[model samples]
Target: MARMISAPVLSQEKRERYDAFRQERTFNAYSVGNDTVMTRIRHKSLDCSPGCAVEATLQLIDGKWKGVILYHLLQGTLRFNAIRKRLPNITQRMLTTQLRELERDGFVLRTVYPEVPPKVEYSLTTRGQTLEPVIMALKAWGDEHTTFGHVPEICADMKGSPTNS
Candidate 1:
């Protein structure tokens, strides 16, 4: 007798509305094996009021590197070292920690393979993919005003390598 809670899947119509009203609330289903136990959608976190959707979001992704990590994963699945290559500035400990947090929060899925080398890959869950528009919006804003250079520059800086002007 064990309980497992997989991510919920929204329908096509609801998916269309996901981006627009995602912040205002949340919903999830609980189950034990194949039997669904319960489901709920509500706004209890913000004193049962609105306007804190953005706050809820920030609580999930508010960190120096989580957003960036999510952005890289958006490209597709990546192995641990590969992710390290992308964000060289992040220490191994920090990267492992963030990845664990993302996995715990249902944003990242980590799969382990039993092999001589023990391969592991990280990808986004359905819930994680829902953040695409938000991540992209942040990228667009940074592109327009940050002048902080793109991924290449960031990677170079992380590696302590010189960049061409």
Candidate 2:
């Protein structure tokens, strides 16, 4: 013997509206009983294409401070204040949000200790360690190309080619 389960049915108009909502690329919503639940659709099913690969990687690290945060974490485990000191420009709220996002994405780990002041430490996970090469390459490129603290000037001895010098 077997038991059959029944699902709640939506009216025709509601079904059409739900279908239209599903057509959007950003998010999808489902109705359960008297409440509606919304879920984000982060990315489409990857088809093993180059564009898909790049998109997936960018989606995982798609924030202004995420890459920099990961770069700092590569050195070693750091407390919240230590990370904040490294990035003095970042606000406490922004750092908290970024850390939460990183933890949610499985790239960073947040561990809390039972103590009088609640010691919390942030460190990179195994998956996050794989980004070392990428982060290092970016750092190298910035060191060579960026003109942050130096005066900008045009080169005169070059003849239209970098190898000419």
Q: In the order shown, what is each candidate's alpha-carbon RMSD?
A: 14.5, 12.3
Q: lDDT per model, in order?
A: 0.80, 0.79
Q: Model 2 scores what on Cα lDDT? A: 0.79
Evaluated at residue 34, the lDDT of candidate 2 is 41
- Name model 1 segments beyond 4 Å from true: 1-44, 149-165
Q: Give the C-alpha miss distance for residue 15 in model 1, angstroms.
A: 47
Which candidate leads the pack in TM-score? 2
The parts of candidate 2 lying over 4 Å away from their true place are: 1-43, 150-165
List the lowest-lDDT window of 10 residues for candidate 1: 33-42
Candidate 2 lDDT tens digits, 1-165: 899655456688867875765544232334455426353443457665768877778878877899999999999999999999777679999999999999999999999999999999999999999999988998999989987542222222223444442
